[model samples]
Target: MAGAADAATTLVGRVLAGRSGALANRLDLAGIRTKPQDFAFLIGVLAVAVLAATLLLGAGWLSVIAAAASPVVAMLFLNIRIARRRDAFATQLDGTLQLLASSLRAGYSTMQALGSVAQQSEEPSASELARIVNEARIGRPVVAALEEAADRMASEDFHWTAQAIAINREVGGSLAETLDGVAHTIRERGQIRRQVKTLSSEGRLSAVILMALPFGVAGFLMIINPAYLAPLFASGLGIAMLAGGAVLMVVGGIWLYKTVEIKF
Candidate 1:
């Protein structure tokens, strides 16, 4: 039974890593896995695929195989989604914060200000804020509603900002200035992050080209000289070498990620 379960886990991992397609995404949604889970699944798949290929190709061709591309593909997808989600939330918060501050300046109560903004804006931020306001209207504390919104997004920045508003409202403070400060800080942080990303663009491009070279060359070799490249896959030793190659690739990736992940 334990062996069977392990086999099933292996199969799912392979399928997820093999291709970035509609089916893979559907599987992800069905499993309710986050971006990290999706990327991890792809890495496992790449390992299995590499082992399979090592049995079919020569040891030298291990670096060039398409089966080893899963990690890069999965990481790219995850990073793109995360970056976009952050941008969307930041953009939405800019107008929402400004409006809320202006409403407070005009003498409206905090909840009323949120409700007014909710009426004019759309999801996911607008609907999110409106839900908080409505919850507060129905006898729920504004703090609870705001906390819920922060939890839903799973963002520390949003959670902290919401807590600031909730605390200020409960204790009585200059909310307009507080909110304006929050918005300005968020915008500035986003600008700085963009600048860092822009500066790192060259490094990112180099990583891509260096990573792709081995795989590209292998594919060309496979197409041009099948018999010559068969030694890697045609023997047990060659298969072992391929597995080792996969491990090295994963370690390299982890190292590169650590190097590039500079928190601004």
Candidate 2:
């Protein structure tokens, strides 16, 4: 049984890692404290709950469909968490950059400034910087550490700043001035991002409401008129229709989300 469990974990890990290790990278970027095993366990539990719910409803095909979708749902939740954390980190980034520049101007080394950021800032930047500082402490190259963090955060501007620092270290330049400029750019971009978000708020909200409408109506009907939608759950064709409608709804949601999401 232990061997079987271990094999299951290995298989799940490989499946999650995928061809590009994108899931692993996302998990890292999200700064989820749980291990992969824990994540897999939680997903399994949710899958089992879904399976149980469908079974209780006497909807075999629906049960299978729900079971199949369980992992996707879990991944979506993880992605949401990662997004929220990254948003928070982005909010903190300008201040972090400014602090690092100030430290440099105050005669601190790059590592010293990073260490201060690690110690002083709030998460997820503090945690990210602390990881970088820890890596450097273990004799890894600081630039490499910064680059790795940038990649993990999926921050292009941060990556550019990292590259600038790397070049400065190799060619000799005013590090403080470079960092100050980067900080200014980051702040300006953040301001623009806020403006865009504000301008698009109505569309974003409408998208969310539209996405939730079907589910909300279904839930309401379940309470007020289960008999009305009973056929939709009773027949095999109904199950298939439900599955297809779910797929279409997911696709539409993605399309709407992409339409509203403005990147600067």
Candidate 3:
């Protein structure tokens, strides 16, 4: 039994190792410090636990579904974290750019200004800027590093900042003033984004409620009377109906999300 268990663990590790690089990048974006193998193992454990719980509840089919959904749920959580981190990074960009501009006005070089911002700012901004500084110190082109950071964070504002820096390097100009102008534009964009979010809050909330309603009803039914939802899991016809409803729900959810999402 011990040898069999060891073999199984090794097999799982090997299977998970194939995607570790991509998963590592995603985990880094999400600000999670976990190793990919460990995260994969945790997800496996969670799936087994969920499967066991469903089995204990006497829903074999539901157990299978739960097992299948566990990794997807974990990915959703990872994406949410990445999004929140990206938002925080974007929110800090205006102040960070202003500070960088101030440093430049104080006679600092571009790299020096970036290093100063890395020291003075908060996380995400600080970490990202520090990375750019480090990469530049190691002889990587600062513009390239900045562009990579922008891509990693998915920040248009940061991408524009990189462009500004690149252009400033190519020609002779007042870098400080250029950064100040960029900061002003970013500040204005932030204001507009907040206004849009405020205006669309109601619609986003409605979408959330609409998406959750079916799950909420199903849970309520499960508690009130387990048998009420049993056929949906037990009978082929009922299972098909449930699958169709789930597909429709997913499509509707995506439609609602796209409808409420305002891109600038």
Candidate 4:
């Protein structure tokens, strides 16, 4: 039995290995330290639990749907975590640039200034800068390291900062001043982003409430009178209607999201 179980685990690991590399990169970006295989196992367990619960509720179709949706839900959660981490890194960019500029003005070389920031700054920022410093120490060009970091974080401000550094290296300019200018621009953009988020808050809230209403109503009905929602899960026509409603709701949610998301 032990050998069989070990063989099953190895089979599962092999099956997941191809996808695990990408998942591991995303988890790293999200600051999650779990091994990809472990994370995959946890998600599989959650999916199985959801499938079992739905089956226990006596809805075969619902169990199938739950099983199918579970992995998607896990991916969505991972994406949200990565996005939040990226946003946090972006939020810290201005301060990080300012500190780098200060370190430079104090006579540190570019790499040394970055190391200083890595030591002095807080979370995400410190770790990211530390990674760049480590890369530079290993003979990777500082500009390339910066560019890679920008790409990883998807931060335009950091990309511009990297550009400025690259240009400064090729030309003759005060690197400190260039960083200070980039910091100022990032600060202004941050302010604008916050204002936009504030203005769109109401619309975002409305979208959430709108998207959740049907599910909320269905759940309430289930609690008050389980039989009321029985036909929806039991009959083919009702199931088709439910699927259609779900697709439409997803489309409407995406439309609402696009409408409120302002690109500047």
Candidate 5:
């Protein structure tokens, strides 16, 4: 049981490590540690496979193959969702900092600017800054409040600003000017990223279609041909090949993804 718990911990630890903002960090603030959802995710993965095979067992060989592959599909979808959300949150980081800088220039104190941002910014950022302001109003130190805010949002861009604020309070410098520079830099970087994404959209789409076409056809074949696809899963060698093929497809997709994703 300890080993199982350890494994689960490791899985969630990886996810949490990959995350920093409102979703994961709030758990720490609320005295909550790791989430049961981590273990649930593992179970969900296994369950997807089991349920698919069971449901399609007597269908066609192609049907069983499709069912067996459902787990991989489900996990891929889950991963895409997580990645998209993380990307969106990261994309918003620069804007959030720009908003903070603008508010500061408008005569708002840091805390007040954050509070106003909480009231106006979109979800996740709004949800997070509101927490920071609330925590400060309850008497948390300004630095701690700001740290908590950074730790919660956890974007590279946002964290840089947070570090500036936290470090500035101790050593002191022109914080607003520093933040203004940072915001401008972020805006420029974001524009370049947007252009890269636009330029790479065709390649990304090709990758998606290339990856999905085979599986989609296999599913359609299973609906039409049962005997033809049966031997592939009934034998161990076939199962290995099936798994290998699936892995190859994933690897290819990842390669295409990286090819198109221009990192700045």
Candidate 6:
């Protein structure tokens, strides 16, 4: 029995690592340790949520389906958090590069410049740089360490900078000059990104309002005239329509998001 249970657990772990391993990487970028523990915690929460919905809320089959999808919802929430933190870190990167460049020009080695970045920069940037520095201190290749951080944070800018550093290390160019140019490019890109965001603010706001309109109206109707919406929840056809609407809403939301999200 113990052997069978161990085999089952191993199979589950393999499936999760194969399918949802990116979640572990996102948690790392968001500064959360204990990826395995967090995954187990999320699964436990999902189980509790499903049980409560079934027993307390008297949920039907549709609700059970939704409950089963709770892990995906939790992952989406976690991805949002990771994206926001990564954006914050990106905003800090240009300054970090500039600082590193200054340190390089002041006669510091690559490793020393990274130490300065860890000391002077703010979170995500500081922590990430510190991680690279620590890895290099432990005998890992510095370029590989930087690239690993860049990959985890999903930052092309940092990846490019790492490439430049690697090239400089091989060809023996002025490292400070290369970093300065990368810093300048990153700063300009950030400015352009901010301008684009500002220009699209109205469209983004309109999309939000449009998406919320149906839910708000439905809620108001439920409060004012419960019988008016009763069939929607009570009848099979109404339930099917609700599900269809939900799927359409999700599709439309993704489309709208893509339309407005201009990437640099």
How do the residues 99-143 of candidate 1 rate in per-residue lDDT, one tens digit apiece?
889999999998888898888775566667877888988999888
lDDT per residue, candidate 3, 1-264, as tens digits?
778656666776799777789999999999899877778877888999999999999876769989999999999999999999999999999999989999999999999999998999998999999999999999999999999999999999999999999999999699989989999999998899899999999999999999999999999999999998888877899989988998999899999999999999
State the C-alpha lDDT per candidate.
Answer: 0.72, 0.85, 0.92, 0.88, 0.71, 0.84
**Which 10-residue span in candidate 5 carries the lowest summed lDDT?**
23-32
Which ranges in model 3 have alpha carbons more than 4 Å from their true place? 1-13
Better of 3 and 5 by lDDT: 3
Indicate which candidate wins on lDDT. 3
For model 1, the run of ten residues with the poorest summed lDDT: 26-35
lDDT of 2 by residue, 1-264 (tens): 778777777777777664425655667777876667657866887898999999999876669889989999988888898888878877888888888988988999999999997898998999999999899999999999989888877788789789889999999988988888888888888788889989999999999999999999999999998999988888889879998998999899999999998878
How far does residue 118 in candidate 3 sit from its true spot (Å)? Answer: 0.8
Segments of candidate 5 deviating more than 4 angstroms: 1-82, 135-154, 170-174
lDDT of 3: 0.92
List candidate 4 segments past 4 Å from native: 1-9, 53-61
Candidate 5 structure lDDT = 0.71
Error of 3 at 239 (Å): 0.5
Candidate 1 vs 6: which has more TM-score: 6
Displacement of residue 258 (Cα, Å) in model 1 is 1.0
RMSD of 5: 7.1
- Tens-digit lDDT string for candidate 6 (1-264): 778655655665666776556666667766777555446555756766786777577666656677777877777777887898888889888888889989999999999999987999998898999999999999999999999998878999999999999999999989999999998888888889889999999989988988999999998998999899989889899999999999999999998898888777
